[model samples]
Target: MPSSQTRPTPAPLLKPGETVVLFDGVCKLCNGWARFLIRHDHQRRVRLAAVQSPEGQALLAWAGLPVDQFDTMAVIRDRQYWERSDAFFEVIGQLSARWQPLRLLRIVPRRLRDWAYDRIALNRYRLFGKYDTCLLPNPDHEQRFLKITMPFVAKSEN
Candidate 1:
């Protein structure tokens, strides 16, 4: 199998037709963002997974991102994976007309946009506190979360 460092496409991670939002499970801010997505996404266009979960780990492996270091939000749509502010814009832009305007942030240089995103991400736990456990989706929304068998673990040498 390809290693997590290889940068995989998003399509294979989804079912026949679906998208996913992979987020930091312990971060309150990220949970808030996921809640925003759940509320605003009327069409149920995307599913959510916590980066600490097995499903999230699998997707991270497929995307070639380290499962141990989830410093950015990830949105997987239309067979592509977007990270950081790009992921933020892409998810919101597709939600509704009201959110479309947020896409304008894309005009900013990626390096600049990501730098700001990184700062907030780095301090999110300090600013917002953390959940002792991953946030649980509402009972009605449980199906929208992806489930996995187990996380992929690399071999270690003694």
Candidate 2:
């Protein structure tokens, strides 16, 4: 098995043919973002997972991200990991055209963009408060969450 520290392109982590959003489960702001996604994503183009969950841990480890400190959110699709602001733009750009204009934020320098994102993200819990537990999908949106049907195995380092 490859060391969790190295990026592992394990497509099996995905429940097949879906874009996944990896987020901070307890962060009210992140939960708000996830709900926003659920509401506007009429196409149902993405599934959400909290970074503290097993599924999120597997995806983050596969992407060589820190599983302990989820200071950033990411997107996984087509066996690729899109992190930080890149992940933000990737999902919004795929949403309805009204949200498409948000993608223009991409033209800003990545350093500046990520810096702003980091400030808000790092302070999310303080600014918005946190949930005692992760968000649970409502009965109607339960299917929009990702669940591990089978155990995820990491690759050994060569």
TM-score of each: 0.83, 0.86
Cα lDDT tens digits for candidate 1, 20-81:
99999989999998888888999888899999998899887777788899799887654567
Shift in Å, residue 157, candidate 1: 41
Q: What does the lDDT read for residue 45 in candidate 1?
A: 86
For model 1, what is the C-alpha lDDT against the true structure?
A: 0.80
C-alpha RMSD for every candidate: 7.6, 7.6
- The alpha-carbon lDDT assigned to residue 157 of candidate 2 equals 100
Residue runs of model 2 more than 4 Å from their true location after superposition? 1-8, 15-17, 150-158
User: How displaced is residue 22 in candidate 1, in Å?
Assistant: 0.3
TM-score of 2: 0.86
lDDT per residue (tens digit) for residues 59-153 in model 2? 87777789999899888875666878888988886699999888877788888888999999889999999999997889998888888886689
- Model 1 misplaced stretches (Cα beyond 4 Å): 1-13, 149-158
**Residue pairs with clashing backbones, model 1:** 4-64
Stretch of 10 with least lDDT, candidate 1: 1-10
Give the clash count for model 1. 1
